[model samples]
Target: MTESVQQLVRYTRIQEIVGDVIRLRASGVALGDIAEVENTDGEVSIARVIGLDRNIVSLQVFTGGKGLSTDATVRFLGRPLDVVYSPNILGRIFCGSGEPIDGGPLLTTDRHVPVGGPTVNPVMRVMPSRMIETRVPMIDLFNSLVESQKIPIFSVAGEPHNELLARIGFQADADVLVFGGMGLIFDDYHFFRKSFEEHGVFGRTIMFVNQASDPLVERLLIPDMALAVAERFAVEENKRVLVLLSDMTAYADAMKEIGVAQERIPAVRGYMGDLYTQLAQRYEKACDFKGAGSVTILTVTTMPGDDVTHPVPDNTGYITEGQFYLHGGVIDPFGSLSRLKQHVIGKETREDHSQVMNTMIRFYSEAVESERKQAMAFELSPFDKKLLKYSKLFRDRFMNIRVSLGVDEALDLCWKTLAECFEPKDLLMKQHLIDKYFPDIAEKETG
Candidate 1:
């Protein structure tokens, strides 16, 4: 005799009681299916049966216990939540649920996969020594975004962090670009798709988007799905993948919500104590797998109220190698740092890259101090005067976000700018480098 099968059951008046919980036994037919519970009001929520005690199963609902009722009907979908993944995901807009909000095709590929899994193991990782040149002066010359380097753009809302990320995707020398947009506004998402398409780079780019209007659960899956597919491309296909995630604050918020649903005790600012570990799991995925392609991550984490001390950014700063702080409509040189820059600063780039970058920034910083002195009517020294002059030239030539230059050209322009503002001796760079790279500015200055 065959074992009897459990029949499906429905509850009609789930909202009649308060503080009531319903338990169901997995019919043993669909173990991994995300069980759906619907209330009499036609409201639906997703829950996972984490504990099964002989006949009764314990489920954790994503939305928590506020509106659910004992009378709610439960149905199992026979599969864990999976995202539709394919090459056609390029140049299209999607909501948090992986649904095409831009009215595109359903992405009917057989390549769907589950998101939010454990990160790559340590034994499978490789040291990150490659450079991903974006040709953006602020990145290539100054901060030097390294391959497999996990970095964040610390910016407040209304800044051009999205635009910067889009520019990098368009220009960066990588085989594939995977972009994950969490809690992005519709306009911003459209802008990214349009920018890539117009630049003719959309074919090599794949976007996983979670908009502000989508359900919160979808936001949690965006990063995982992106990193999972990226890992496959890198390790299996030997493709250099660059993953761009915008507004990680949204991802943090999703984690916080899940923590609340699980009734876990909150740590700083109502965030789960595992916040650091969770972030590390994703960021550590930036690796150069041995004998294969690499995955480099550049994410945007918007600081709420411009507070770097906020829990989200504070934890992020610790986990990431360095940060690009965006402020006042520009990448703030004083606030940015790239810890992995040494790997490529003087190796993959021009010999003068390190010196030129440091000297220009040092002078630019002094120029800022000189401007402050001028504001207070203090007498300016000769060096201060030179600093003020060089600062203006520096801002125009290199600091502008719209400015573009190859690594070599940028270094040459640095020499030109320094020659125009100060004497060769005053540049304080090695005499040998000055002799080799300094343009005819020395003769022009002396004459």
Candidate 2:
């Protein structure tokens, strides 16, 4: 029998209920198939099959399984969870269950697409060689987020990672923006929606939010829904889509909670053994489609207690291309890296881009060393004083997250900062770059 025929199968006996997970004996059930569990009281709850064991199947209720009795009827939908994808969804907000929460008109169901589908085939992927400028000096001049690259912002609790993410959402040069907030508090959710609206990007953005008070199973749906819509926009509409998912640690924790309810064997830190696989499945959805547009993923992975060794961040470090380390309210130049930056830096940007980037970082390293010497009360050399000056200028000009500048503009500012702190000879950059792009302070005074 076909899947549609299988949809007619229904069972009235629920064998077990553990937390939000319910198990029943069914023969024609498939994993990821949606089902309706109707209570004897005439209320129905939606659920999806999560596991199978020959004749037994486990389903996770989208609504908590509270007050659900053993006699609840299970009628399989024979299809996976789907989200609406159309121009009507633009500027709209959805909850984890893919329902509209923005008080907008209900979208037609004819345009719905299944979530959690397979990643794009390698044959359909194109090389990512373009840069997605965010106008943030640190990322534009230093890390250079590349199109179709999957990277994360490694942050800790109480940091402004969401603010940075929101800044990128409004400032990034992309055709569409998809924002997913997993386990966010009401205040953070309000901030994101308000930021996009105030910056005038809300009209081109789609949001999938799962608040902290929502059902645990629904938190798992946010990324899948956002990515499903983003993929359609990139492939069908041929638009460059940027996806931002914040606090993936909460997503992982939701998985762990479900795993514990299902009594699965635990891996390191009580997380499921498939944690890496789950994360890779989502991150790999980022791709530059051949002969079409691209989908770039930038996520926020919070490391608990500032510990990188935590399972969520540790597993994430292996899956993503690179990370932007956010610490002490700034993107740490020393810890942040973009492995694909070589594809665009100096090629898509100004020729002086690479030289200025390397020189600024080198001088900043020395300046940090100079800071240590000053702290120890050691005698400071004349050059150390210059390094200190350069350090302060660099922090104010480029390191501050709020400082925004175009790539070329930031490069010019780099040369100015260097010239003010040291002579042209002091900079080890190529003479050609210095001669061509370097400022002529002496000639200016003479003129």
Candidate 3:
């Protein structure tokens, strides 16, 4: 990386200060350039040049511009935002500004990589084929996670999105985990850290958190820092890295707030016009390197008012390969999908895996119909009664998010649940599988 040039400009005349924005008359100020504002009390704060029109430049002060006057000075750092990248970054906790808040040793390396770097070239990206098993049947058996695939968990506010993310962090088949938490509450942060420690994966996980009490401007830095470190791990170290971001809605809110402060025209739902481009810039970072490790992104996008049309989720749906709809605390199989799962499901898993997945879903769908029939007090067929029983078993056995079953064990349990509910002929499976897995249910049945 080339060394960043420091412009070192000082402007004392402040024209306007409104909502963490400082406007002044300055020349040669480039957009995205870092700035330092020294108040009259000799205290300095960091900022970045967000807008420049004619001789007027506007900087978004990271300190929220609490107290300022014409006596304040601004220095334009020639480079955009940056963070240090090294192996030492693992197992460390940093604030949204990429500074260690855990009182740990400062980054000893002098190497600085700019944040929000460009996406990888399509030519450099290999087709993703490997599966990332989390041992959750809903994901492993149904929507298999593929390496380098960008996907999101569509959920609402009260859903256990964070807990689900932490669960994946604990169990995902990755060499490293990078978690970026934006606008998170203190209790949520504590929960994540404690859960990681209890699960014994905290040592391999790196956390960058922007708490609710932190400056909103800094919330913009979490994704960049998390992705920067994860990219370094995947490229330099050749480690399979999984990046998990919670509540991207909060990040979008931060962007909206900053845009409002900048006086930019709002787009749909008061979001910026560049929403898609900005979001793609980050999600596109998920890539599978040709002979190296991959970086897979699994983010949580909380839809406001549970509306999928909300601008944040609406724009996100276009960028991601598929989504895991997390409704009612369990991953709704009807709503969740893995577009890339086909690349690895049958090719990587057992032969019976695909057949079992289809059979179970088919039965589950029929079970839903049976439930409707029962609700309307219609006459129930023997098969419908069986489906009602199977429905309860399926939910308790598999759909329950709390059920912790490995992929292989979950597949075996599917056969167990089927044999207990219906005869082998009722399964509508291939005769070979029926004979192989489903023993004579009649003989096993108690009179």
Candidate 4:
């Protein structure tokens, strides 16, 4: 590593004040040079002189004020923030500061790039018609995961959202998986790394982690770094990439902090007014680029205090195509949905897929109503009694997140479950589907 330390003499009089702002006069020849300020006590921060009036130079520090002094030495690095990018970055773990944390040697590649560039234009986007199967029953059979789809897991803390993400990372059909962890606990990060490795999928996975103890500024860079690498792989290498970001609530929190630092006006619940726009920029990055591979994003957005009405989840609901609602250790059939499922459910999957999915969910919903009626001791019809029975079976067989099945198997199971509760004629599905998939429950009943 090359070290070039240049001192800023004029910065001697600089004093770190409230709000982390600093006032300095450039008395040395290092005016306009990027400097890293450190206190005599060995705390470090990066700052750039953004304004200069006469001999006074104004520097904006990346780290918010907590420790500093007039005796702090300012060393100018003479460069802007840059990230190393290359194929060699694959299968490696990097910290939020873009440093390798996987006990590997630093990449000496000259392919350094800046993060947070503009998104691709809409005209450059191709229609997303391809499906990316994760083989998780809830996703594959019911809510189909589509290529270039940007979906979020709307969950609360202590939920198995991270485990769900790791499962998808291990099982997703994409060629590459880029995981960005923001404000994740050490245990969650370890779980993801171990899960990928144990499943023999680590070589195809790239992780950029920002733990809760890292600097706040670094947390803001993790998503961009992960997305930037994913975009490169999708465009240049023509590899289908799946980007998994855990706890986007932390990303939004970083934005809120920056907004407060910049003295911006707060919108709903003290979040910046540009929250929606900022989120859209990142979500829209999920695109099928023309003549290239696609990038799909599956993010975990934990609702604060289990409040979906909170700004983070509220804005996300509008921008994302759909969401997987993780509650009570299950992907709620009624709460979860995939808007793009209609595009490929029947067309790309088995003929009975759409019918079975819809019929099963419809029956499940009716079962809920029937259960309520039974609870109230209402006079229930024979059909209502059947629905109540079917709902219980559906919850046990399908609603459990741990239940894994392929599309065909899930559809077949759906048919068997329905047959146990309702007659074939009462299913209301198409005649062809009824003839093709209905099990021989009639023979069992007669026998």
Specify the highest-lDDT model's number.
Answer: 2
Which pairs clash in the backbone of model 2?
Answer: none
Model 3: CA > 4 A from native: 1-12, 108-110, 439-447
TM-score of each: 0.86, 0.97, 0.95, 0.87
Most TM-score-accurate candidate: 2
> What is the RMSD of candidate 1?
4.4
Error of 2 at 435 (Å): 0.7
Error of 3 at 420 (Å): 1.2
Give the poorly placed runs of model 4, Cα more than 4 Å off: 1-35, 38-67, 70-80, 442-447
lDDT of 4 at 43: 87
In model 1, residue pairs whose N, Cα or C atoms come closer than 3 Å (at least 3 residues apart or on different chains), thus clashing, are 33-79
Q: Tens-digit lDDT track for model 1 on 149-221? A: 9999999988988998899889999998889999888899889999989999888887888778765666777
**Alpha-carbon local distance difference test for all models:** 0.79, 0.93, 0.88, 0.83
lDDT of 2 by residue, 306-335 (tens): 999999999999999989999999999988
Estimate the Cα RMSD of every predicted model relative to the unseen true structure: 4.4, 1.8, 2.3, 4.4
Q: Per-residue alpha-carbon lDDT of model 4 for 327-430, expressed as tens digits?
A: 99989888898998888887888999988888888888888898999999999999998998888888888877767677788888888888788887888999
- Comparing 2 with 3 on lDDT, the higher-scoring candidate is 2
Candidate 3 per-residue C-alpha lDDT over 1-447 given as tens digits, one digit per residue, 9 for 90 to 100: 244453355455678998898899988777788878888889988888888989899888887977777678887766688887777777889898788887889885657788876898788899998999997789999999999999999999999989888888888889999999999999999998898889888888899999999999888889988998888888888999999998789999999988999899999988999989889999999999877779999999999899999999999999999999999989998999889988997788877889999999999999999999999999999999999999999989998776788887898888888888898778888989888776465644641
- For candidate 3, the per-residue lDDT at 316 reads 95
